[model samples]
Target: MINKLNKSYWENRYVNNQIGWNIGYASTPLKTYIDQIKDKSLKILIPGAGNSYEAEYLWCHGFKNIYVLDLAHQPLDNFIIRLPNFPKNQLINADFFEYENSFDLIFEQTFFCALNPNLRTQYVDQMHQLLKPKGKLVGLFFNFELTEEGPPFGGSVFEYNSLFKHQFKMNVLEPSINSIKERQGKELFFIFEKKS
Candidate 1:
């Protein structure tokens, strides 16, 4: 049976503490990318931001306009507890596709892979819609086989390229050089600029 990775599904995972995807800290690849961004005022969104270590990292590093969105309330709750000073308004508990707001940058961590594979098209479209013109969608994507057995579903480089080629200008799609040990060679780092 196809696992419909919906809100309830995710909420249950958090309730059960079955989140193997939670790395407990901002991923090295994302941190390295965030470090290079010179625009501190960029409106940034981190969807499916479980534990939101990246959001915490961004806020701590002076990125004031950061937003953290999650389908499940458990993680967002944890984040608020961890970073109480973070703006309560920026902690969004909502479905990503339904959340309407344009941002200069969106950080993709496990969000795409966590969704059901059938939503790939919708994910791309929503991402395109959510980004400002010439804005970027940057992060790591798993470079593994796509199968029915996972919320951490995977896709090949060719598949990702084809799915995003039409709307995003490929700026940097390649093997991530600074992935954490657990994800060493399994992820593809990408920086896709929304096509103008």
Candidate 2:
């Protein structure tokens, strides 16, 4: 089994500034997708939200029902500092596996790949339980091979489909055309809706 990446493990990553996956701004593909979303009232959740630039972008664009959850307090604190007026209650510091809520939309940034491979199934189940009927899970998924050594572990289309298909009907799962230069060919932007 892969080593558990528990709260302290992640909190220390933040404390030591070891988060290499933090892109200072919202990802281009997700931002473009957000630009086309007409529903400002959608109850959106960004789980594993590290120093959430995407949540900041959503708030700036008038999406008021955004929930930003992270296991570590450091990043959440950083986020609140950046957007002091954002609803404090909406910033959750908790384990995704235990959090309960039904969201209209859930944004997946680097969350999936960061968990230990053994928890992938639990991650899928938790995500399935977190979305309202017909709600969508949207965001970028890294496309590459999985390896033992990674906080940024990798995966592919087949693995994603197998894990999500039982609960979500994939609406779109294809190479992201607008990935940032650094991730140009390594990300797949997807939209998967709950099967209910």
Candidate 3:
């Protein structure tokens, strides 16, 4: 079994500033998706939201009802400091699997690859449970091999399809045309709506 990815494990990664997954800004693909979204009040969740630039971007664009959840307090605190007027209640410092809430959308980025591969199915189940009926789960997924050596463990289209096809309507799972230069060919942009 992979080592425990408990709260402390994540907290320490934050405390030490070892979060390479943090892109320091809302990813391009996600920002593009947000730009086209018409609703400003859609309930949205960004789990494993490290330094949540996406949430900040959403807020700046008039989107309320945005929830940013992370296991560590550090990033949440940072977010609070950065956006003092943002609702403190929306900055959740909690485990994703245990948090009980539903949302119209969940934005994914780097969170999936960070977990131990053993938890992929659990992650799927939790996401399915947390989404409102017909809710969408949209984001980028890595398009590489899955291995034991990472917080950024990789995955491919085949693996993603095998894992998520039963529970989600695969709306768009293809090479992201607008990936940032650093991730140009390494990711797949996907829009998966929850199955009713």
Candidate 4:
């Protein structure tokens, strides 16, 4: 049976150091995307941001308004230790579903895959509600068959298209050419802009 996805489950993963989803540093695709962004003042958020290397990278690159939220505190604590200068107020330990705020951009990594499949529609809606008009939700999604047993649940282009088409203008949703070796061809790099 699939394990219950909750704060305890994620906290236990951190407690045991079983975070295989962590790639140790900011992902190359996201890093490159961030590099092209000229605006340092964008209001950014990373929900379900476990050991958020992306947020670290953004802050180090002069983006001051970045926020990181996770259900557990351990990973956020770890992040705080690594970046002592990162604003404490921006590091939130909260459930993503309960988080309420609008941002100019949101970055997705393993967070979406970590949720229960039944929450997919809610995920899309929450994303829509969180973004400012014409803002974007961008990142990688696993490209495989969805099954009953997974926290890293898989999905396909068709499934993504059907879920996001109404609320976002799908800009790109294709195989990630720069994914880490293990995820190459098994992930899609997407940019979905909230419909204005």
**TM-scores of the models, in the order given:** 0.98, 0.98, 0.97, 0.98
Worst 10 residues of 4 by lDDT: 1-10
Per-residue CA lDDT of candidate 4, range 1-196, in tens?
3557888988999999999898999998999999999999999999999999999999999999999999999999999999999999999999898899999999999999989999999999999999999999999999999977787999999999999999999999999999999899899999999997
Task: Please report how far candidate 4 places residue 45 from its true position, in Å.
Answer: 0.3
Q: After superposition, how far is residue 72 of candidate 2 from its true place, in Å?
A: 0.3
lDDT of 1 by residue, 5-80 (tens): 7788889989999999888999999999898989899999999999999999999999999999999999999999
Poorest 10 consecutive residues of model 3 by lDDT? 1-10
Error of 3 at 115 (Å): 0.5
- By TM-score, how accurate is candidate 1? 0.98
- Tens-digit per-residue lDDT, 73-157, candidate 3: 9999989898999999999999999999999999998999888898999999999999999999999999888878886889999
Please give, for residues 1-196, the per-residue lDDT of candidate 2 as tens digits.
2586899999999999998899899999899999999989999999999999999999999999999999999999999999999999999999999999899999999999899988999988888899999999999888989888887889999999999999999999999999988888899999999998
Model 3 residue 51 distance off true place after TM-score fit, in angstroms: 0.3
Off by over 4 Å in 1: none
Model 1 lDDT at residue 59: 92
Checking candidate 1 for backbone clashes, the offending pairs are: none
Q: Please list the Cα RMSD from the true structure of every candidate, rounded to 1 decimal place.
A: 0.9, 1.0, 1.1, 0.8
